[model samples]
Target: MKVVIVGAGIGGLTLALFLHKAKISCEVFEAAPAIRPLGAGLNLLPHATTAFSELELLDRLLERGVETSEVHFYTHHGQFVDGEPRGRFAGYDVPQISIHRADLHEVLLSAARERLGDEAVRLGRVCRSVEQDPERVRVNFADPSGAALPSEEGSVVIACDGIHSVVRKQFHPDDSAPIDHGTTCFRGVTRWKPFLDGATMAYVGTYDTGKLVVYPIRNSIDAEGKQLINWVIEVKKPNDGVRDWNRQVSIEACIEPFVDWRFEWLDIASMLRATDEVLQYPMVDRNPLPFWTRGRVTLLGDAAHPMLPRGSNGAAQAILDARLLAELLATKEPLIALKEYEATRLPATADIVLTNRNRSPDEILRIVEERTGGQPFEQISDVISRGELDEWQSRYKRVAGFERERLPQ
Candidate 1:
């Protein structure tokens, strides 16, 4: 059976690679005329990296990205609350990788082309709509200029087109609206000296005041030995209803909220000033759909479940979807495979979507903030116990399908 995959982003390309490895024929079609190095930093949890390990591309990714060692939580007052080891450092066999979105895409795209041939990925084909019968699926496409392109036929169609998916809209038009979280996030990467062991992922403050997530994506560049540090600032604000991912905004808008965020370990204000550019995006996600499959076409990744970027599970969950769907499609009948993929992944990812909205890993900071009334504490233990902190972390991991014991060996 042949598969037609839409959108050559992380999910689509990874699916292509997995399908090729499974000895299944597939092709990827992307809307953009070319795939360029875009997007900021994202993390691949141990579970996500396990799929890359199976693809034999983990080493290349490791060579380009940082193996995150630990994750730490702090308060708006810059007081340390709790910390834990991650990936191999957390006793998992695979390591959690923190890499630039572009670097990871490069690795996947390069491998796909090498293995599946360059022509396997068709660029500039925007999916207008999809029509399928019992025999086969037909995907209609248009060029970036709105000119019609030849429709492609395949046994099945998988939509990985992201939050603004055309195929998803066609299937579930009533659920097209995004649930705005009433928050704006500012993200950027800056060249700076490492902080807190060089590989630590740090989350500071609560959403009511200001929240900042900081980590290094690329290690050591140039003569001064500065790492590429990625930082995101999330603040509760009225949603402007804009969803552009590359919306550039002044650095002052991002720094005003955290003017006094100068901690003993890292000066958050200075990091914002040093950033060359900052991209702003509305903190938005769609409510979980009742279903993600109908006939031979199914949704994957952001198309299937677009969750808030809270626990760094966006890309990781998509990777999980690709791995599982590819395996099922290779072994089971195409129609049964699509149904099973939805039955398995839809509810699982739906839980993540709701959990991200209500309680995420960062909820630890929120809990501490609420318990202490957002004040500086003389002692962390007096504010929250170690057991409480561990429980919060473990709960999020389990819901997101990355619990140490739950992961497959």
Candidate 2:
């Protein structure tokens, strides 16, 4: 059976690789005339790493990405809140990778092109719609000029399109527009001297006012030992702006919130000012649809489950979805496989969506922020008990399908 996949971003390419490995015939349709590495850093948690390892691309990813040793939490004052060894350090078999979104995309895209052939990924093809009957599925696309282009037929079609997916619209046309998180995030990558362990994922401050999440995506350049640091500034607000991922943000608007964030280990204020470019994205997600599969077409990645970017599950869940869909298709009938895929994942991801909305790992900071009345205490232990913090972290892990005791083997 032949399959057609829409969108050539991370999810689409990953799906193509999985299909190729399973000996399933498929083609990828990407809207961009050319795929260039775009966007900021993305975390590939262990579960997702498991999928990449199956595709034989882990070594290449390790070469291009930073293997994060620990994920640490901090207050606006830079005081340590909590730190945990991630990936193998945390006892998971796979190591967590902090990679440039572009680097990860390129690695997957190159592998897909090499294995599936240049014709496998049809660029300059914008998928406008898909139609499926009992016997076959047809996909329609337009060129960059907005002129109608030829349509292709396949046994099935999967939409891996990013957040604003047209196919998802066809499935849930009556769904209210995606709800905004009431927080606008400004992100950028800058070449700067390393901070902390040089491979730390750090989240600081509170979003009630402003918060910063910073990490190193690349180790060094020019032999100066300067690392590529990716940082995001999220602020609570009635944000009004375009929702485009590539939207440029004025450094002044978001930087002001962190100006007073002076700390001993790193001058948070200075780092914010050093950024060369800043991109703004409003944290927005739609209510989870009751289903993602209908007839011969199914949805994966952001198309199926778009959630808040917090907790690093955006790409991880997409990777998991691709692998699970491939597994189901390999073992079951296509239509039944789609339903089984949804049965296993839809509720699972819905938990992630709501968990991200309420109690993510960062909730520890929220607890500290409120319990201490946003003031520093002589000892963090006095502010919040270790048990409480561990509980908060554990709960999120369970919902994200990574609880310490229950992680998949």
Candidate 3:
């Protein structure tokens, strides 16, 4: 069966690699005029990294990214809350990778070109909508100038077009707008000296005022003890604006909430001040659909389930979707395979969407913050028990399909 994959983001390109390996006839159509190295930082959990290992990309990924070791939690008062071992330090077979999104995209695109042939990926084709007959599906595309382009037909169309997916809108026309989640954020990468473990991912403060998530994406970017560190600062918003990753904002406007974040371990304010550029986005997610398939078309990744950036599950779940869908389509017919893919991923990711809203792992910090009245605690144990913390973390891991016990070998 001939398949058409839309959106050449992480999910689309990876799906092309998987389908090619399975010997399934498929092609990828991208909306961008060119494949530029775009986006900021990203996290690849063990489940996602496992997929890379299977594709023989583990070594190259390790070279381009920092292998994350643990997650350290703290409060605005600069008080330690708790921590958890991640990747190999946690005894998982694979290591979690913290990387620049552009680096990861380049790796996937390179692999796709090598395996699927350079002509397999067609850029500058913005998909408008999908039309289908009993025998095949046709995807219409428009050029950058708002002019119509020749449509392409295939056995099925899988939309990986991202949060603002036009293809998803064509199907779920009345679905509510993206939920703002009451947070506006700025993510920037700064070249600075390493903090804590150098490979640790740290989250500080609750959403009551501001939340800071920081980690090093590159090990060494300079000669005199410098690392390319990625950081995200989020504050409670009065109302949500347009959520665009490419939009940038001034640090001064966003720095007030974090100026006093001078902990013994690291100076949050100074690190943010050193960033070369800061990309802004509104934290948002859509209500999950009961179904993602209408005949031969379906959704994947941010296009299907745009969860909050609370957990590192976004790209991981997209990889899972692409893997499962390609496997099913390689064996089953188009209609049957698309339904199977939807049934497998829709509810699973839907659970992640809802869980991320209320009970994500980061909620532990909020709990500690609220329980301690946002004050510095003499002992973290005085606020929450180890049992409670473990339960809070493991539940989200399982819901997001990255539970250690259940990971595919």
Candidate 4:
């Protein structure tokens, strides 16, 4: 069967790879004129890592990304809250990777070309609309210049288009607009001297007081050994700010909150100032839909379920969707397989969507911030018991479907 996969982002490329492995014929249509590595750092939790490892892309992922050693939490005053080992260190078969968004995209795209052939992905084709019949579905595309392009027919169509998915809008036009969480973020990558273990992902401060997530995405961008550090400073704001991925932000506008962040291992305030460029994006997501598949057409990745990036499950969930959908289509009838895919994933992802907004790994920091009055704690166990911390972390793991105990033996 010929399947048309929309959007060549992480989700679309992964779906193509999975389908290829299943011996299915498919094509990826990307809106972008060229597929280039873009975006900042994306963390692959152990669950998502397992999916990729099954596809045999783990070594290539590690080669292009940093295998994150631990995730650390800190107070606004720079005191350590908690540090936990990730991936295999946490006893999972796969290791978690903190990779540059573009690097991961390249790895997936390169594999698609080598395994599925160069013609597998067609660029500069913007999907306009889709119409499905009893036997086949027709997808319409337009050129970058807005000229009408010939339509293509397929046995099934999957929309992997991201946040602003046209296919999703076509299906759910009356749906509520993306829910804004009243937060604005300033993100960018800068060439800076490595800090800490260099492989650690750190989250500092509180959202009410401005929080920072920092990690090194690349080892050396220049001859001087300066690492490409990716940092994001999210502030609780009254407005959603903006939506453009390439939107430029002034460093001065968001640096006031980090002025006091002078941690011993790294200078958070200085790193923001040293950034080569800054990109601003609003933290927004939609309520999960009841279903992602309709007839011969379905949704995958961000299009299927857009969640806040708080837990680093944005790309991971998308990859999981692709893997699961590919698995279903491999064995069952196409139409029945799509429904089974939804049955297994829609509710699972819906839990993550609601949970991400309410309780995530970082929620622990929120609790500590509230209980400790946002001050330095002489003893963390007094402010928040280790038992409380463990419970908070465990709850999130179970909800995101990555509890260590749930892994296959």
Candidate 5:
């Protein structure tokens, strides 16, 4: 099947790689004039890493990123809540890799070029709409000046355009603007010495108040033995400003609430202040669509379901979507393949969207904060048992399709 993929993101690039692997004809179109690495760091769980393992890109990702050894949760007061091993340390065959979004994007971009050829990716093509007949689906594009460009034709089109997807909008024309869940995330990267074990990922505080998730994305980028740490500050707001990911705000405004985030393990306030740039994004998501596949067009990644970003499944689920869609399309007829892709992934990702909305692994800190009444406890066991904490983590894992037991030995 000849496939046209909209949005050359992690999901789109992944789909491109898989299509090439299957020797299926496909092309990737991106809106941006140039694909620069954007956004912060993200965790690659085993389920997501499995895609990399199959593609033989796992080692390259780990070489540039930190192999997450453990995950730690702490209260806003800096008291420990609970900790657990991750990646191979958790006994999963694949290691959970943590890396900057830009680095990961570049890796995927480079691989796509090498495997699919340089001319495979068409940049400066912003998809405005799509139309499909019985034979082929075509996407209308616009140039940088908003001038209409020639429409591209393919057997099918997959929208990976993210939350602001134009293809998705064309399908669900009246769909209301993205529903804001009252949370705003301020994210940035800072160079600092390792706090806990060098490869640990930490989630401190609670989202209702002020939550901080910090982890090292790159190791030893500077001469002073400092690792590039990615941190996020999330706070519940009655009203949020713009929802753009690259929206810049005063660094002081971003770190104002985190000013008192001082801890023995790491000085949160200092780290927040040390960052050169801070980008703000509203924690927003759309309700699951009734179906992702409509005729010969479909949605993937944030376009299909933009879940709350707390659960660390944003990119993971997208990667999985690409893998599955390519698998089905490589076998079934174009139209039937789109339907089968939706049947397999729609319900699965929808569940994760709701799960992340209600109670995600990130809420482990919120749970402890509630039990302790937002105060430090003599013992973490006093606030909550280890079983409860383990349940929180495992339950989300199961929903995200990465539960250790669910995998084959």
Candidate 6:
């Protein structure tokens, strides 16, 4: 059976690789004229790393990314709240990889091309719509300039086109509006000396005040022995309702809120000042849909569920979707596989979507902030107990489907 996959992002490319491994033919179509090394850093939890491990790409990913050892949490005052082990350090078999999005995309793209052939991915083809019958599924595409392209026919069509997916809109037109959470995120990368073991993912402050997520994506880039540190600052603000990922903004506006976020360990103000470019994104997500499959077409990744970019599950869940759907398509009939994929993933990711709206792993910092009234405490135990911290972490992991015992051995 042949598959026609839309969008050449992480999910689509990974799906192509999985399908190729299963000896099932597939082609990927991307809207962009070319795939450039864009985007900042993101973490691949053990669950995601496990999938890559199966594909034998985990070691190569490790070469380009940092193996996250631990995660540290703090308040806006720089007061230490709690810390926990991650990936293999947390006893999981695979290590959590914190890498630049571009590096990860390049790895998947190169693999897909090498295995599926260079012509496997068609660039500059925007999916205009999809039509299907019992015998086959057809996908219509247009160039970036709105010129029509020859339609491709396959056994089934999978939409991995992401948040503004055209297929998703055609299927669920009325309910495609994004829900804004009144939070604006500013993200950037800086070449600087690492702090806190050089591999720690640090979370400082709460969203109500100022939330900063800091981690190293690449290590030892220059003669100064500096690592490429990725940082994100989230603050409660009015969103202009634009969802462009490449929206560039002045760093001064992002720095003003955290001007005094100077800590003995790492100076947040200096790091922001060092960044050459900063991208702004509004924290938005679509409410979960009732279903993801319609006849011979099914949605994957962001096209299936666009959850708030918390808990780092946006990419991880998408990778999981691609793996499962590819496996099912390889074994089951195309239509049956589409339904089963939705049945298994829709509800699971739905819970995560709703959970990410409020309660995520970072909820620990929010809880401590609430309990301590955002003040610096002499003893962290005096505010919240260790048991409470563990509970919060475990709850989020379960919801995000990355609990150690639940992951594949």
Q: List the residue pairs that clash in candidate 3.
A: none
Tens-digit lDDT track of model 4 for 1-409: 9889999999999999999999999999988998665678878898888888878999999987888888998888888889889888777888989888999999999999999999999999999999999999999999999998999899999999998888889999987877888777778888889888888999888788788899888886789888889888888874454666777868986888888777899988888888878888758889999778889999999999999888888888999899989999989999999999999999999999999887878777888889988878998888887888778878888888888789664
When superposed on Cα atoms, how far off is each prediction in RMSD? 0.9, 1.3, 1.2, 1.3, 1.3, 0.9
lDDT of each: 0.92, 0.86, 0.88, 0.87, 0.88, 0.91
- Candidate 6 regions exceeding 4 Å error are none
Off by over 4 Å in 2: 404-409
TM-score of each: 0.98, 0.97, 0.98, 0.97, 0.97, 0.99
Candidate 1 segments whose C-alpha is farther than 4 A from its true place: none
Indicate the residue-level lDDT of 92 in model 1: 92
Task: Encode model 3's per-residue lDDT on 147-166: one tens digit a residue.
Answer: 99999999899999999999
Error of 5 at 325 (Å): 0.7
Candidate 6 or 4, higher TM-score: 6
Question: At residue 222, what lDDT does model 2 achieve?
Answer: 51
| Candidate number of the best lDDT | 1
Model 3 TM-score (2 dp): 0.98
The TM-score between candidate 2 and the true structure equals 0.97
Give one digit per residue, the lDDT tens place, for model 1 in 1-409: 9999999999999999999999999999999998877879999998899999999998999999999999999999999999999999989989999999999999999999999998999999999999988899999999999999999999999999999999899998788587887888889999998888999999999878789999999998768878999999888885688888778888887687788888888988888799998988758999999988989999999999999999999999999999999999999999999999999999999999999997999888888899999889999999888888888888998899898898877
State residue 277's C-alpha deviation in candidate 2, in Å. 0.8
State the weakest 10-residue window (summed lDDT) of model 3: 236-245
**In candidate 6, what are the lDDT values of residues 69-178, reduced to their tens digit?**
99999888988888889999999999999999999999999988888899999999999999988899999989999999999999999999999989999999898578
